[model samples]
Target: MDHIKRPSLSGLTGKRHSSRDRSKDDAAKGKQKRADSPLIHGQQANGAPSPASRPAKAASTMSIVIESPPNIFFGTPTQSTGALFSGQLRIAVVEPEVTLQTFTMQLLATITARKPVAKDCPECAKKTTELFKWTFITDPKTLRAGDHSFPFSYLLPGHLPASTQGMLGNLEYHLDARATTRPTPSKGAEEITFRHPLPLSRALMPAPEKNSLRVFPPTNLTAHVTMSPTIYPIGESTVLMKLAGVTEKHEDHQQRWRLRKMSWRLEETEKMVSPACPRHAGKVGGEGRGIAHEDVRPLGQMELKEGWKSDFDDGNIEMEFRIRPSGHVRPLCDVDSPTGLSVTHSLVIELVVAEEWAWTKRPGVATPSGAARVLRAQFQVVVTERAGLGISWDEEQPPMYEDVPASPPLYPQSTAPERSTSTSHPHTAGSATPAVARAAAAMNGSGDMTPVVSAMGATQRPPMERRGVTTEYDGPPLYSPSVVPQAVPALNMGGLNDALPRDEDLEDIDLGESMRRPGPPSHRNSAS
Candidate 1:
């Protein structure tokens, strides 16, 4: 056979190049590809369009403006009438006119669990319920370029639980609004959504203080605890405790319990039912089934080795301490929701007591009997926000103008001059008479004789005229003027005469010196 020229297989065979040379070739190829393609490496070529060049999205936005005060339930859930929440939803349209197909808003309550039934499963983590819904636009409506507002008001049910965030779960409220708009009839509708958080709180009016008594069996020891009905998170709460029956008497020896140590802690407990979503319902058994979870943690604590007064004679121990919620822990307030979510708090106290023996004759000298007991007590406590000065919406005052003052205006002081009357008694150039002494005592602020003095100083009726009967008496004076004593000795009791007017000072004094009355007529004859 003639071998016409067997082609060399080496022409089709390849020789491997070094790693560095292969890398350089690859780099050059990538550069060329980037330069030739307009959208390569997330970069645009000179003639290619930029991201901003794409069709514009819907030129409309939505927002909410709360017009009413903060949402705060005034009293307990059973008694509260609920809070009124009013606000306006504003839609700003950039285009000249846009047709809105549907506009609606909803109030949603959501509960989220920190520890779900199934790890990494969102369906077992959160659940949301719609509380209320508002349909602003039922039919397609056209709005010109500007801002349009839709006012909304709702009275939240009083039975609903307040918003709460705990270690195990969270209860929250939100306002979710959506607006659907279509720029062109041929294009699909675009949705604009807005979400806002709504925080709610409840205040339980303070109630009477509570007193609890606990008696330990087999022992006469009794614990009396006094605590406030409601505890505030921001301020301090006082706990008054009295332990009695610590001392036991015997014929020969005395047995007594001595406090060694005491400690207290505030525990916060949270419970939540983690409901599975439709997709994960099989994991929790079936629909409407959920996994119950509970978490307990301490919000605050204190240990006391001392600070208690022990009286062996009285057989009692008294102690008082103040406690406040830990700021660092950010403890959640008490809440009980209808969605199987709840939070509560309790105060736990533990005391260590040891028994000792002492002779009745020498009670001060005692020896430990090596017998001890641990006394534990737990009390329910409410953790809540302070009920500030803010009153409920129903009790709020009517709106007042800015110029109106918070308090009523004060009236101007009286400008009329006061009547000036002399309080000093008048004197005569002689000893004080009985009438004068009484008048002087009355004028000296020691007695009240206004009517008697006015009658005595009145114009004396003519001796011939009868006083009450409109009849005439033409007879001489009933008696001689001599009947009136000229000089009566002044009273000298308890040096009171020094304060009274003297005989020599009578010249400057005038009896019946009132502006409306004339001086009394002299009883002595004019010649004398």
Candidate 2:
């Protein structure tokens, strides 16, 4: 619209016009510079590389450890109890919440020189190496519940000798690991492994957890042994005995007791009766009846002596023995008889042992005054007769030239003929025969001949001999033969037939009536 001419002097007017134009140009240049800066653009839009393109730093290292329970437990020298031996170690791995999917696990083992031996730098001289092995099914594949069981096993070194003598003091081992990830399908991935070393010392003491099923420590346990009928007959009788032990665990509960098992067998004497005639002097007679009388009496009631409560914590055992007659034993007496003879009989018994049972409250449980030890305990079974008594109903007639009536010998006495002292050695070959004699001496508290000790005159009677036995008959004795019993196949020991002869390692015994002596130590008390 209205064009007005501004007044400008010569120098002032030129400077003002020049300054306005310069300021406008400077503002335009600043805007252009901002457009070229990275702050104004996104990461992708920037020409420089992104942070993700650079390699990441390594994570802090983690540690893994192994542990074991008790070093020893009860075990039998020859048997395997289906349990790991004591003093064995178990391993486990741990991570500090890192990228586990990209990490891999690997194991290794090696033997290092010991401090005492390695001081001389024998590691290189020994030519030892790091060994890698797989056992108990490794590689879990998936890390989830029920995916698989913990596959673990011990590595027995090939070069290490058994622990007897001249063995390495301890063992050394190493474990390795790695991390991995799939960056590209074509190029695959790279592995970064981590190496770790561990050392273990050899066991100088016995293992406490040997042959035990529990993985954790167990409470202290005390044991008590009880045998039924501390006495046994030569034949047709089963001896039932129970071995029970107790454990003290928590204070609120009573001590726990349990039975393990029971096993028994009658060992024949070294001296055997005539196989032809086992009973009478007939063509064939029952075993034991020919030279000596053998009658299998029914099992009697068992009684536990006083103070038996300490025997068990929470455990009890009931056992039985049944003696069955053998068909072969009857054939000895029926060689020329009108009817076939049956001498089959059976003895049945059950033995029980427990791993856990009720506790017998003792004074120590709450007080000390009431504490008492178990002297004896009894577990009995009332057996019902099937065919009734097989022995004769009439009273048994006494044999001629027999000693006064008294308790019969549970074991057969030695009948070895005494040799003349003119021989080279009197103790040789007859050394084992004195087992019974030793027992008799122990019972009589004497070192002299104890087979027969007389307190009246301080005289000893010679042991009886079975060479000649004569009986005077007043008249024709009763000829009524008792019904012979039948034996069950189950009564056979380990499928061995009675007709087959067995090798019995027998010891000589001279047990007689009124001769109270301790019996032989039984193997039944042993822990498997």
Task: Give the top-scoring candidate (lDDT).
Answer: 1
lDDT to native, each model: 0.80, 0.32
- Colliding residue pairs in candidate 1: 431-488
Candidate 1 C-alpha lDDT tens digits along 366-393: 9999989999999999887776786777
| lDDT of candidate 2 over 1-528, digit per residue (tens) | 358867658658667778779999998897677667655333344345467555654333334434432112112222212112112222222322222235434444432222222234343113234344333223322222211222334433323211111122222345565555333453445444556554322212122221111111142332232222212222233333333334555555454433333333221211112122222224334332322112332332322222123343344333434433332322111011111111112222223323332324442443222332322222321111221222211122355456557777687675644322221112212332344335435654764432332232232333444669554443222231111112211122333333333233233343554684544557434621
Candidate 1 ranges with C-alpha deviation above 4 Å: 1-33, 36-43, 47-55, 118-122, 183-186, 277-286, 397-528
- Provide the global lDDT of candidate 2 against the true structure: 0.32
Score candidate 2 by TM-score against the native: 0.19
Please give the range of 10 consecutive residues that has the lowest summed lDDT in model 2.
331-340
Best by TM-score: 1
Write down the RMSD of candidate 1 (Cα, Å).
15.3
**TM-score for all models, in order of appearance:** 0.68, 0.19
Q: Name the lDDT value of residue 369 in candidate 1.
A: 96
